[model samples]
Target chain A: MKLQAAIDRVSLDRANEIAKGLDGIVDIIELGTSLVKDYGFETLKREFVGLNESTLLFDGKTIDEGEYEFEKGFEANADILTVMAGSSIDTLSKTYEVTEKLNKQMFIDLLEVEDDKIKQIANFKNAIYGLHHSKDNKNAFDAVSSVAAFHKQFPDISNIAVAGGIDVDQAKKLSEQGIANIVIVGGKISGADDPVAAAKQFMEVIK
Target chain B: MKLQAAIDRVSLDRANEIAKGLDGIVDIIELGTSLVKDYGFETLKREFVGLNESTLLFDGKTIDEGEYEFEKGFEANADILTVMAGSSIDTLSKTYEVTEKLNKQMFIDLLEVEDDKIKQIANFKNAIYGLHHSKDNKNAFDAVSSVAAFHKQFPDISNIAVAGGIDVDQAKKLSEQGIANIVIVGGKISGADDPVAAAKQFMEVIK
Candidate 1:
């Protein structure tokens, strides 16, 4: 399993510093939606200028205008971009087409998508299916159990990722379960006092 | 019926000029999601410092982290912020609570939300329910018919807003239909050779 570190709700300068510190240490680096919305993609794109090692993912969470958002995301040098699973099938199909045409990747965020909706959108075989929990919800999420259930329900979804408040221990267990292609850790790693040390700990556990 | 002129996919300078020109002419001035993504909310917020007349509606299209996004959106002086109807009941409820506390407005974008989902989310009495057609979708949307069908299905939903490819004739017809409380026009009004004149024409028809 690979580790995806998400940097969120911080200034562009701080985000850049963190990304620089974490370069080559993590598998993928995510510029969270807050950064994209707070600083704008034009500025964020400039911040992402020279990362030699890790792939950059922009969590655009595009719910509509998939083509424009995808094209802009790619132009910003995003190796992967995200779209809401709750978006129209037409929107999902369009983003997937753009991703394929650009020879890049798309992560479909399953934040509030129902099974019926999921059934309709699961045909994007090459896209990474993200089982995500909303950060605003006060309810607790059992990441391991959620992943297991998701795998059981959609066995054909090969490239799967799980996000929302994933910690080092939970990530270790998820790695042992051998289900998700990538385990995304946000505050647990990025919000720590020493994010680099925290990231190292997570990397050790996931490996 | 109110006219909402959405400014999208343009440079910040152009958007600001357009907003300045259309300020009091339109009932609501939407800073489209593309602007928010391309320019960042901080910069966009700064640009919106001195608008005197129309309510500024930022198309945040927030899907997760409802409280944070809502707080940031409102802090930017937006009178109205949008949340995706496809978001979780928890997320939607959280955003509604924030909007209520702040005494601001919330617009729920029902781009691809299902009837079952709408049934669950329809109780936010103060929220303006938006019937939006995805821009990425190639299928044509009959705005008047869609609004009528939506009104028929959810009679309790009083404040309805319809968007997508609305022209002068369609806006006039929708006003004549007397179903929607607001009609949103994007390219037809904002993309016109003379946007201010186009906006005035829409306002005349609606009024």
Candidate 2:
């Protein structure tokens, strides 16, 4: 399993600072939706730089107008962009086509979607299927069990990611489970007093 | 019925020009999701200005982190902001609370959501329930019938809006239907050769 450190709910400068500190430490560094919506692609493109080792993912959470948003996001130098699985099939197809054509990546955020919806959208082989828990729900998300169940349900979906209130222990357990390709940790790492040290703890456990 | 002229997929300067021309003619001026994602809220707040008449609606389409997104969207001078009906009840509650406390408006976009979900979220009586057809779905949308059916299904949802390929004829029919409080027209108005003239056509028919 790989560790993805998610940076969110902070100023652009601060996010950049955190990103730089965790550059080569985490496998993927996510610029959360707050940054995308607050500052936007153009601003993010110009400002968010200097990452050489880790892949950068922008949580675009695009629901419609997939072609335009994906094009802009890719142009803004995003290695991977996200689209909501709840979007129409046409939308999913469009974003996937854009990602494939550009040779980048797409992360399908499965937040608020059912198994039926996931089955319909699961055909995107290259896209990472993310089992996300809503931030506002304040519910406990069992990363290990959730991954095992998701893997069992869809044996074909090999590139899996799980997020929502993930911690170091859960990360370690998920790595032991060996099903999820990426374990995304937000707030715990980004909101910590020392994001670099916090990310290092997660990285050590996941490894 | 009220007319909302949506500005989308155009340069910020062009969008501003069209917005200025349609200011007093339309009841609401929608800075579409395209504008929000492309230019972002900070730039939109700084650049999109000088509108004295129409209510400014930003299509935030916020699925999570409800309070933060809603607070930033409202701070960006949005008199009205949108939240997706597909969001969790917790998210719905947070956005609604913020909107109510701020004495502003919330437009709940019912894109790709089922009747069961609508029933759960329809309690935000002050929020506008927008019956939106996905832009990616090529199927023809009969706005008049959609509004009628939605009204029949959810009678408690009174403050209603409709969007998706609305023309002057549909606008006239929806006004006669007497259910939808607002009709959102995108390409027919903002994408027309003369946006002001197109808006006038819609206003004349609705009246």
Candidate 3:
């Protein structure tokens, strides 16, 4: 399992600092949606650099106008961009097409969609299916069981990522489960007082 | 019916000029999702000005982290922000609550959602239920009939807004139908050779 540390709800300078501290130490560095919506692709393209060894994933969370967003995101040098699974099939297909053409990756966020919708969009072989838990919901997330259940439900989707207030222990469990390709840690890693040390801990556990 | 002239897929300078030209002319000036993603709310707050008379609607299309997005969107000086109907009820509720507390407006975009989902989310009385046609979908949108059908299915939803390649003819039809409170004209106006002139034509028809 790979570790993706998400930096969110902070100034670009702070996020960039955190990102630099964790660069290449983690497999992926996610400039979360807050950064994307707050700073945008233009600014991210110019600033927010220093990820030489890690993949840079902009949590664009694009739900419409897929081609435009994906093209713009890639132009900004994003290794991975995200699209909502709840978006229309046309939107999904367009984003997937754009990602494939550009040889980048798209993470399909299964945030608030039904099993039926997921089944319909399960054919995107190259896309990473993200089993995300909503941050707004006041609920506990069992990373291991959720991945197990998702695997049982959609066994064909091999490239899986999971997120939502994930802690280091959960990351270790998920790694042991060996089902998820990427375990995304947000506050537990990026929001820590010492983000680099926290990320190192997750990396060590995952490794 | 109100005329919402959406400015999209254009440079920020161009969008501001267009907004300045149509300040009080149209009921709403929408910095479309493209502008939000490309330039961002911070740049928009600083640069994209000239809406002294009309309501400024930022199509943030927020699907997660409802409170943070809503707060940032409102802080950027948007009179109205948007949330996807496909979002979880928790997200919808949190956004609506924030909007209510701030005394702003939220438009719940009904794009590619099932009727059951629509029925469940129809209770946000103050939210404008936007019947948005996916830009990626290569299908015909009969704006007037779509609004009528939506009204018929969910009579309780009063504040209706419709968008999807709407033209002057359809705007007129929607005005006559008396269901949609707002008719969102995208390319027909914003993409027109003379956007201000096109907006005047739409304003005339809607009036």
Q: Highest TM-score: which candidate?
A: 3
Docking class of 2: high
Fnat values, one per model, are 0.87, 0.79, 0.81
Candidate 3 has a TM-score of: 0.99
Predicted candidate 1 versus true structure: per-residue lDDT over A6-114, tens digit per residue:
9999888888888888889999999999988887788777765547899899999999989999999899989999999988887888999999999999999998878
Predicted candidate 3 versus true structure: per-residue lDDT over A1-207, tens digit per residue: 999999999999999899989998999999999999998898899988658899999999999999999999999989999999999899999999999998999999999989999999999999999999999988998879999999999999999999988887888899999999999999888889999999888988895
Predicted complexes: DockQ each = 0.83, 0.81, 0.87
Model 3 interface DockQ: 0.87
RMSD for each of the candidates:
1.3, 1.2, 0.8
- Chain B TM-score, model 3, reads 0.98
Regions more than 4 Å wrong, model 3? none
Candidate 3 docks at the CAPRI level of: high
- What is each predicted model's overall lDDT from 0 to 1? 0.90, 0.92, 0.92
Ordered list by lDDT, greatest first: 3, 2, 1
List model 1 lDDT by residue over B51-163, tens digit each: 78998999989998888889898998889999999888888999999999999999999988779889999999999999998888778999999998999999999999999
* Model 2 spans with C-alpha error above 4 angstroms: none
